[model samples]
Target: MTTTFDRGLALLGAILDAELGSAGYPGNAQLAARIGLDQATVSRMLKDLAALGLIERAERVPGWRVGPGYFALAAAAGDSRLLVRARPLLRGLVARWHEPAWLSVRSEGTALTVEAQLSHWSSYVAAAPGARTPIWCTGPGRALLLDHTEQQLAELLEGVEFIGGGPRAARGIPALAAYNSADRLAGVVVADREFEHDVVDFSAPVRDPSGAIVAALSLAVPRFRLADRTAGIAASVAEAAGALEVGAL
Candidate 1:
């Protein structure tokens, strides 16, 4: 009862998993060997995947890897769920704190905003959905790192350029490690004027039902408004994030 389409889809999935496991792009023969398919069949299926934008060939090298279309599909499916579930919660944060709130998830080593509730305040930092900020420089980014291992941290920081934004912006791995340690212990992170000198970001991790970190919920406000209320703001964000996890279940 196996249809040709089903078999083709299975092959595509196998090829994609193989490519994901490889360090670099794989050639058709390499993929065929990995997936136990003949070279000619693998080549034909690769062409089909390329046409569907599920896989792409390297421009400068004779190899293949997963393509942007795969990521787009993933984001649409997964991020949309998170956004929908977090919308009311983000709105609540804005309503309660009178500050902009954001929901972000890690994508390609950056914190990609998927949802935002802008503050009614005249002077506010506006962040549109799909805006990307470096993981090394944002509160949500550091909060996302709480689950990363030391080796993962090194890999993430490798070759990343550090730009100064505030007095507390971490300049090197040692400082970043220190920040991560403290944030992990506290279950939240506060970046005071880290991205913008006038902006203070408070963030807490959003975990899935299985206790894996899935995203971060954060609030951004003018530094002047955040004076002496860091703990309270962090607690609110953490409470909202916990509500999101419960809703997910």
Candidate 2:
């Protein structure tokens, strides 16, 4: 018993899932052919999708892909559960390190902050939820990269624009590989003024019971205090991540 409404929903779901798997946006003609719909119908549906925030045009190109609306809905559902378990731990990290603590998850090819607890200090890094950062330039980004395979990393790096915020920022795949290697060995990653010269970030992976990395827990501190506190900060972040994992289990 399939109604027109059900069929329409199915078409929309197919479009979203197909776009998710695509490395680049497929034009209306391509999508219409794939979905077995007429070009005009697909165009109309795409308009509706765009208006609903389920799809968006690429900023630098003439194509459509998953939009913030989809990510926002996914994040709201997933992050609410994650925050329920990670919030107290993030608060603990902020108290222990006297720095802002953040929880970020993979959003397409970028890192999206889902939760953050600001430090009490007057001068501190500001990371609001939904803030998106490059996957090659931040501690949590690098930490998240540790889960990617070489082929996946290569694919993700293709067409990526390197926006170096400082001398320490990773500008290419080689540098990102080095960072990932170090993070894998140490079980945590540190980015010192990579995204912003005045900020230092220490992050560790938050794993689910099945051992997949679900998010990254990070401590954001001022660069002036990073020299002597790097090790301590890393340890604190790691401990918080461990607690998150335990709570998830």
lDDT of 1 at 182: 80
Tens-digit lDDT track for model 2 on 169-249? 988777778778877888998888888777888889999899999888998888877778888888989988988888888
Candidate 2 positional error at 117, Å: 0.5
Error of 1 at 199 (Å): 1.7
Give TM-scores for every candidate, taking all chains together and pairing residue i with residue i: 0.68, 0.69
- Per residue, candidate 1 scores C-alpha lDDT tens digits across 52-165 of 456788778678777654674467456566778889999898888888898877777877666788777623452545556778778888888878776788888898767765
List CA RMSD, all candidates.
10.8, 10.0
Candidate 2 has which clashing residue pairs, if any?
Answer: none
Cα shift from native, residue 17, model 1 (Å): 28
Query: Roughly what TM-score does model 1 have, to 2 decimal places?
Result: 0.68
| Predicted structure 2, TM vs. truth | 0.69
Global Cα lDDT for candidate 1: 0.76
Weakest lDDT window of 10 consecutive positions for candidate 2: 1-10
lDDT against the true structure, each candidate: 0.76, 0.76
Looking at candidate 1, what is the lDDT of residue 108?
72
Off by over 4 Å in 2: 1-70, 120-126
